[model samples]
Target: METGWRRVSARKSASRFRRSTSRSMEESTSSAWRVTHRLSSRDSRLRFLAADDSGSSSV
Candidate 1:
């Protein structure tokens, strides 16, 4: 095996691996954020409903 060719191939593979990993990370982060946002909104709505129900009951 030629040392120079091996080095070049290793570098190429490393760069390709980095690009793929970065893209996957971005996708996962976006999906996670979307899920978190959806959950938070739902929780807030439920809390609001509970508060409204209590206020009406007290009145």
Candidate 2:
């Protein structure tokens, strides 16, 4: 009977760990996406500035 209880406890612990890990993974994925989006926006702004600079230099 004690062994059965231990098994049930272990299963519950494992389920909880899986749920926490899944939540963390989702958070990480969303954060990564936000970082990439910010990086891309910065890159686009730099490209526009460079184009303007070149155009002014040519004139």
Candidate 3:
């Protein structure tokens, strides 16, 4: 019963996240790039490229 309840809660949150992302891929994509830029400033170009790839794939 405890495990079942945990699964249900996790599913709910996962669906909520999926809904938010899928509903506005453009918004998420922009936000993603923004963060990537901020991170890439302190990180590597490879990470930036990885982020861009993921963003495009999601779209």
Candidate 4:
């Protein structure tokens, strides 16, 4: 294999790999953030419900 051609091919493949990898990473990060946000909001709602329950029971 010619060294020049091999080097060019390798560089092209490496850049392609990086581009795909970064795109996937961004997608996963956004999905993860969405999941976490939903969970936190659910948790807060649960806490509020529990508090309301206790207060109602006391009254």
Candidate 1, residue 7: how far the Cα is off, in Å: 2.6
Most accurate candidate by TM-score: 1
Instruction: Give residue 34's error in model 3 in angstroms.
Output: 17
By TM-score, the better pick of 1 and 2 is 1
Q: Cα RMSD (Å) per model? A: 2.0, 2.5, 15.4, 2.2
Which consecutive 10 residues in model 2 have the weakest lDDT in total? Answer: 36-45
- Cα lDDT tens digits, model 2, 1-59, are 99999999999999999999999999999999999999999999999999999999999
Q: What is the C-alpha lDDT profile of model 4 across 1-59, one tens digit per residue?
A: 69999999999999999999999999999999999999999999999999999999999
lDDT of each: 0.99, 0.99, 0.91, 0.99
Which regions of candidate 1 are displaced past 4 Å? 57-59
lDDT of 2 at 10: 100
* Pairs in clash, predicted candidate 3: none
lDDT of 1 at 46: 99
Q: Candidate 1 at 58: error in angstroms?
A: 4.5
Sorted by TM-score, highest first, which candidate order results?
1, 4, 2, 3
What's the true lDDT of residue 45 in model 2? 99
Clash pairs of candidate 2? Answer: none
Count of steric clashes across candidates, in order: 0, 0, 0, 0
For model 1, how does the per-residue alpha-carbon lDDT over 1-59 read when each residue is reduced to its tens digit? 69999999999999999999999999999999999999999999999999999999999
The regions of model 3 sitting more than 4 angstroms off are 26-59
